[model samples]
Target: MTAITLIQGDITQQSVDAIVNAANSSLLGGGGVDGAIHRRGGPAILAECRDLRASRYGRGLPTGQAVATTAGNLDARWVIHTVGPRFTREENRSELLASCYRESLRIADELGARTVAFPAVSAGIYGWPMEDAARIAVETVRESVRETESAIEEVRFVLFDEQAYEAFARHVR
Candidate 1:
């Protein structure tokens, strides 16, 4: 297995095997990381996302599910998109976000991807707390990396800013 690297960088700039999209259930792309991904990945990403929108499961996604598409203009060969919930009063919000990492990893493995990069899921418009989100994101990815039954060599978290970078970096140990 390849060693996972925690890098302070841009998800859009990283040349990993696959980049995880912090998307809504619609998958059509919205603001924050989603908007950046959509813009950098170009129109083809939207076209393919539009093609799959109607088939989106209830709650934007069934838990622990993910979809794949051409990376469009993004550096990676493909993008593994997963929807994480907005902070809500409902149950299982933590588990749902954790599933975003898990399901995306599962999809990456299926595609024979060795390296994957992720943004800080739900930390933008979704309003999940940075410190808590950082802890969960790191733990989830680390645990998933361990439990995956496929040939996933590396998992990375790419941060867009110093604050986010420091927050995620706190989990490196």
Candidate 2:
């Protein structure tokens, strides 16, 4: 079983193999975790994002899917970018939310990333309920590991605040 850890801190600071970004579909860097990663990771990350946009992901990355780029100045070796679904009360989109975790792990496995640090996807400006987001993130990562037999040995949920940290902790424990 993959070890799951909850850290109440910035995701960029973790010295892991990969850091998962809660990216917008454009992958051009927006607010929250996406902007922070792009700002700290430097031009190399944007350059690769440009290359991805020009080549395979011309129309922007689809929601619930994940792609990777160089970590640049960050501590990690790679950044797994995944667009999460915005919270919607009118429809049930928890599967898409769960897919964010699953796909990131799949990409992490492909990159041989043994340790990955992740922020609460869609729980920031996208307005996902913190508790539900935490539950989905934790449960999906656990389920994916059980099903795929991935190379990832550790999945760290690096939350920005105590509330978010405690929320994820509930599920992890």
Candidate 3:
């Protein structure tokens, strides 16, 4: 079984096997967690992202999909980049949101990552409701852990503020 933990801190600072980045499809680095990771993780991360863009992801990574790159200066060995869908009330994109966690974990399993830190994907600039995002994240990770024969031992939800922490806490507890 995988242990779920919550940490109210920066995701980039977590010393885990993999750090999940709520990245844009471009994979070229943008604001929020994406920019933070690309900045702190150094140029090596950007270099690899550029290569991914040039080679396979020329059209940019699709929402709900994930890929891996070097952690660069971060404590982890790999940074799992997952494109989260923009929340829309008119259309139900919940499955796509859930796919972010699922795909990220799949990539982590591929990389043999035992520990992973994830942000509240799409809860920031993408406008996903905090409570719903937390619920989906916690539930999805729990289900993914139970269903997959994965190496993941610990999954940490790293929140940047008290509200985000509390939101996730409700689900985790």
Candidate 4:
């Protein structure tokens, strides 16, 4: 079984096999976790993202989908970029939000990553409620780990604040 761990720290600093970036569709880089990763992971990360944009993701990565690139200066081997859905009360997009976790894990498995560090997808600038985001992230990861014979052994949620950490901590317990 995969262990769910919570850390109230910067996601960029985690030394895991893979680090999940809560990236925007552009993939080039943006504010919040995406910009932080791009800045810390260095130019090599951006170079791969540019390649992905040039070849496969010409327009941009679709929401709920994920892709990977080199970690560059970070302490991981790969940076798995996943675009999260923007939350809205008019429509239900929880599945897409959950897909961020599921797809990221799937990519992590594909990369033979045993340990992956993730930020709270969509909960930052995308307006996903911290509580709901935490619930979906935890539940989806738990289900994915249970259902698949995956290589991931530890899935760490690296929150940037106390509230986010507490939110995830509630579900992880």
Best-performing candidate as measured by lDDT: 3
Report the Cα RMSD per candidate: 2.1, 0.6, 0.5, 0.5
Per-residue lDDT tens digits for candidate 2, residues 1-173, read 69999899888899999999999999999999999999999999999999999999999999999999999999999999999999989988899999999999999999999999999999999999999999999989999999998878899999999999999999999
Please give the clash total of every predicted structure, in order: 0, 0, 0, 0
Candidate 4: tens digits of C-alpha lDDT, residues 1-173: 78899999999999999999999998999999999999999999999999999999999999999999999999999999999999999999999998989999999999899999999999988999999999999999999988887878999999999999999999999
lDDT comparison, 1 vs 4, better candidate = 4
By summed lDDT, the worst window of 10 consecutive residues in model 3 runs over 142-151
Error of 3 at 73 (Å): 0.3
The regions of model 2 sitting more than 4 angstroms off are none
Query: Could you give me the TM-score of model 4 versus the true structure?
Result: 0.99
TM of each candidate vs. truth: 0.89, 0.98, 0.99, 0.99
Judged by whole-model lDDT over C-alpha atoms, candidate 4 comes out at 0.95
Residue runs of model 1 more than 4 Å from their true location after superposition: 54-64, 89-92
User: For candidate 1, lDDT tens digit of each residue in 1-173?
Assistant: 54556777779898888999988777788888888899999999888887776565433555446898889999898888887767765655898888888889889988989889989888888888788788888888878877765587778888878888888878866
- Predictions in order: lDDT: 0.82, 0.95, 0.97, 0.95
Query: Clashing pairs in model 3?
Result: none
